[model samples]
Target: MGHADLVARLVEAGGLPGEWRSVFERVPRDAFVPDLVWDDDRRPVHRAREPGRWSGLVHRDAPVVTQLDDGAPDGVGYVSSSASMPSIVALMLDELDVAEGMRVLEIGTGTGWNAALLAARLGDGNVTTVEVDPVLAGLARARLARAGFRPAVVAADGMAGWPGHAPYDRVIATAAVRRVPYAWVAQTRPGGRIVTPFGTAFHNGTLLRLDVRDDGTASGRFGGDVGFMWTRSERTPHGSVEERVLPGHDHTESTTDLHPYEPVSDFDAGFAIGLRVPGMLATVVHDGAPADGRFTVYLMDPGSDSWASWRITPRPRGRYRVRQHGPRALFDELAAAYDWWRRIGRPAHDRFGLTVTPDGRQHLWTDTPDRVLDLVPDPGKERAG
Candidate 1:
């Protein structure tokens, strides 16, 4: 019903810890949210026109998309920024383990709600937030100021971090990155914590927590499954490529017993597949009713023109049609990845971890550092042209 009620529920559910309860109550989410906000469905709700609906959406345990395409046409555009869900904010802050008077650096200011919460806990002067878009940064700064909290909000790339406020006790990112930027580790004090959503090009990632070492290396495991917007520099144009694939290119037909949804639908399996098979993107398009159980999964390689499609139909037991073309057999690669995931007993997110060396070599390991996933090229599979 009300924001306070929601916060109490979250605390009872263990989403909000007791230490952060006072801060959450003091920093109202509505003050930081904009007049026009988009719900999870991508539909816009104006506070001026629909105050009731807007208030309900803002207090709910969900993200409200604030800026679309970095504040383009507003109502109808790809989401570029938003106020992160309250539950996730609490979870990440809990993982941050911040204490009063600790200096913190936050990547992606977004709507500035997070900075307000941080400022409430650690004081305004102790928090520095960086945003890539000048417009977004200005808006967040204004919002933070309006909410009676002002942190050092900078309009610059978050990847570089804010070196002027160096040696932060904690660094957290609201965006997703393929690799943990070296600058973040370097700027953080030794033994400090760095938290961010780390994922592959495939778009399935988990929130990673790393402990910065004196040598500037960061290593830790996946804290949990999280979906966040890509860092501006890493964002790429992608979607249904069915039109680009076209007809009469090159294709081979085959059959497989594996269903198309198995790997893509399961969180652990999809993440494992993404890690094992790098540079591959998987998207599934449903046909007719879901009860009809007919869909086509498209897998593509961003580096090449290679693409594959698997057509699945409703059946108790049967072979599914698979069509693939270009230099890489996309389906074959995916199958191999899924097989690897299965062989490892379909480990969950916590079972996986990442290590970023001082030299910038990132390695993904399962359970321990000794058993790392190999991404090396295989000369044995080279095409004999």
Candidate 2:
């Protein structure tokens, strides 16, 4: 599709704004993408001046992986940086409500595409982006400058929120953070908006948009689902699933008499489960043949080294079995959350909201009105070694 068609699709996807469609059409996505990057299939693809192919690739809904293996672009390890998919970036910008002349602070400046767009919307002087990786930051700075857009590009830990330019009108983080940094809340002006993908031990990311209140308490609804690169400081390998014990199972198998398996990506279902069963981590693993597929979901806890596995059989229907085991019975918790979701008529994303206090306390709430659930630890405590 051409630029016009692409922009139209983005609008339909609720990604591009009516006012910003022109900017999307004008800014060359191909310019910001590095020469060497990975495509959707995780295959390395080089960008060349083939107007037909390059334009199509840039317009696709998939994210172009810009940095791999912690900023190593040579495809040596995991994805660390990316020009976030068009829809995801648009969704975040929409939540941010960035307007002309607003001072914006963006964390995780990866390929400079986002920074360029911010510069395009709110003049270069009004935007400041912080990138933790020196190499990535330098490349983004040069790329933005070459594209005729230059924001205050700083190479510093984004967790700190660049105190030199305090009190920003809007603060958005491109990276996923385990805890909402106190610095971000402090730097945002009262009534200003702060948007970020708050990570949990859950299966998906939650898009949090909080309004900074006069007393430093921020509250708002969870806007949508997003997946982002984890902050550098929080990056670590979650030990192999095999090492963790599976609840109620003596060994791995193909079938059992538990909850039937269903293959559907329901964000609300996962979020509700996460909230109901706090501190539980679940990972989805797809296996078996294409025609006869099977899925194994493992739920575990890092603090207790406990876990459970649910196996779904392909009886050409949604049939599955859930087994509980381990010191912390994860399967039982998951089953309880699943039943709760059903009892509540499967609450959607709109019903959920996030409230963050000045002291760095975060709460996830449903519209039905219950006390906010605290997801982070107290700031005063530290690991006792």
Which candidate achieves the best TM-score against the true structure? 1
In the range 1-385, model 2's lDDT, one tens digit per residue, is 7556767788887778787787787777777888877666676666664555556667788787877787554544688888888888888888899777789999999989888988999999999999999989999999999999989999999999999988899999998765678799899999899999865555447787888889987777775668777777655345567766634446333334454242125677776676666557677677856455677777767665566678766674544666555467777766777787778678786687777676676766777326554434211112100
- Give the range where candidate 2 is weakest over 10 consecutive residues by summed lDDT: 376-385
Tens-digit lDDT track for model 1 on 132-208?
99998999999998889889999999999899999899999999887778899889999899999877656546899
Q: Which number leads on lDDT?
A: 1
Question: What's the distance in Å from true for residue 220, model 1?
Answer: 0.3
Global lDDT for candidate 1?
Answer: 0.83
TM-score per prediction, in order, is 0.93, 0.84
Give the clashing pairs for model 1.
none
Show model 2 residue runs off by greater than 4 Å: 1-5, 11-14, 48-55, 72-76, 242-265, 285-287, 290-293, 314-326, 368-385
Predictions in order: lDDT = 0.83, 0.74
After superposition, which runs of candidate 1 have C-alpha atoms over 4 Å from their true positions? 74-76, 376-385
The local lDDT score (0 to 100) that residue 370 gets in candidate 1 is 71
Prediction 2 global C-alpha lDDT: 0.74
* Ten contiguous residues minimizing lDDT sum, candidate 1: 376-385
